[model samples]
Target: MSRRLKNNMLTTIAYVVVLLWLFPMLYMFLSSFKFESQVAVPSLTFTPTLENYRAVVTPEFFKHLNNSVLVTAGTVAVSAILGVLGAYALVYSSLKKANNIYFWFITTIFLPAVAVITPVYIVLAKLHLLDTKLALILLNTGAGIPLMIWMCTTYFKEIPGEIVEAAKIDGCSKAGTFFKIMLPLIKNGIISSALLVFIVTWNEFFFAVTATATQSATLPVYMSKFMTQQGYFWGKMSAAGTMVVIIPILIGFFTYKSLVRGLTAGSVKG
Candidate 1:
């Protein structure tokens, strides 16, 4: 085939794949505007209504949403602060075996949440922390910090060491160099890292469901309420799902360029 024809074929395949990927989301979006009775019917001709949205937006929903926002914000804030400092240390500190320490951080990323949930639960229970936003914040921060370090380290490594040296010679304290100089250079990487942690902590379900009850449940746990003994409330669930996803979708859409750039930032390192 000619090159132009091959390109056209590839484009068609891409479009088809995108449509297939988005069809479920499109269906759910449409279904949220439907009556509970019409949701499972899978037809597009009926009139859309706001009943599902109204049902989904209860006070309980906002309470759970507030939990999610607070937990996510706390996790991201803690993770970014610690991750930046950790990455900076690994890259610039004079400590021996720093590379080994960096490797240890990378290894933590592979440790599954299930591996430690029992001990974590016990620890939280002893501290009377279960069902608390602080518990979720701490858990999600631990989960996010490793990835943040891994990502921010790349941005740090890409910077010239000489720049750090220059900062020192100019009478910049270690903290001054870190806060005033190095951080500004990697602001995009930090933003990308924080955004990622925000998304993860916001959508966290397993820890939220297991550690939290009525009070500190996040959106994912609230979404589970739809699956009651009566049956799945598809219409209301769809509406809740839409609300749960829309914020993250908007954030990802707005910061996609930074995310893409940050992910690929270290690809061409020497």
Candidate 2:
């Protein structure tokens, strides 16, 4: 095939992939405006209404939304701070076994939540932290920290060590070098990591279901409530799901450039 034809083919393939990815989300968004009967049928020709959204957004839903927002925000903040510091230390600290430490962080990422749920439940029970937003925040922060370190380390590594040396020679204290110089340079990476952490924590189902009764249940748990013994409330579920999805979508949309830059930072040198 000619190069022009190949380029057109590739572009078409990309569009097809994007359409495939977006179709489900589009369907779900549309379904949220549908009535319960209409949702079961799944026909395009129907009058859209806000009834499902109205039913979905009760006081309980707001409570769950508050819980989700708090947990996501807290997890992102805590993880970012700890992860950035840890990544910086791993890259620049003069430790003999830095590789071992990094390996430990990476290993924790592979550790399944199910495996540790029992011990986690017991610990939380003992501390009387069950059914609390703080518990979810703490759990999510721990889960996020490993991922943050893994990602931020790449951004930190991309920075030249000579920059640090120069900062030091210019009488910049270690703390000043880290906060004033290094942090700004890797701000995009930090934003990317925080956004990822936000999405994960927001959509976290298992822990939210297990740890929270009602007081601290997040949106995922709230969305799960639509599955009743009578039947699935598809309309309300879709509405709740749309709400759960849209926040992250808006956040990602706003940070698209930063996210792309951060993700591709270490891909090329010079």
Candidate 3:
């Protein structure tokens, strides 16, 4: 086949794949405005209604959403702050075992949540933190730290060692150099890490279901209420899911460039 024909075939395949990937999300979004009866049918010709959205916007839903925002924001902030410092130390410190330390950090990412949940639960219960937003915040921050370190460390290592040496020679303290120089240079990496951490914490279901009750329940936990003994409230569930997805989508849309740049930065070198 000619190169042009091959390119056309590849483009067609890409479009098909994109459509396939998007179909479920598109159907869910459309169903959020549909009636309970209309959800089972795949046709898009039915009239849209606001009842599902209305049902999803109750006080309880908002409360859970507020909890999600707090937990996600707190987790991201804590993870980013700690991750930056840890990554900087790993990259610039003189420790002979820095590589080994990094390897250990990477291992945490592979550890399944199920493996540690029992111990974590016991510790939280002993601390009287169950059903509290602070518990979720702390848990998410710890869970996200490993990923933050991995991403930020790669970005930090890409920085020129000469600049760090020059900063030291000029009598800049380690703290001053990190605050004034390194952070600004790696701003994209931080933003990217924050965005990823926010999405993960926001969508986290297992810990939210286990760690919190009504008082501190997040959006995912709120949506779970739709699964009743009678049947799944598909309409309301879709509506709540739609609302839960909007913030992350908006963040990604606005920061697409920065996220892409941050993720791809250390993948190649000049």
Q: How many residue pairs clash per model?
A: 0, 0, 0
Alpha-carbon RMSD, candidate 1? 1.9
- Model 3, 122-240: lDDT tens digits are 99999999999999999998888988998899989888889988999999998998989888888998899888888889999999999887799999999999999999999999999
lDDT of 3: 0.91
- TM of each candidate vs. truth: 0.93, 0.96, 0.95
- Candidate 1 residue spans exceeding 4 A from truth: none
The residue-by-residue lDDT of candidate 1 on 17-51, one tens digit each, is: 99999999899999999998999898989999999
**Among all windows of ten consecutive residues in candidate 2, which has the lowest summed lDDT?**
261-270
Off by over 4 Å in 2: 268-270
What is the alpha-carbon lDDT for the whole of candidate 1? 0.90
Q: Which residue pairs of candidate 3 clash? A: none
Report lDDT (CA) for all predictions. 0.90, 0.90, 0.91
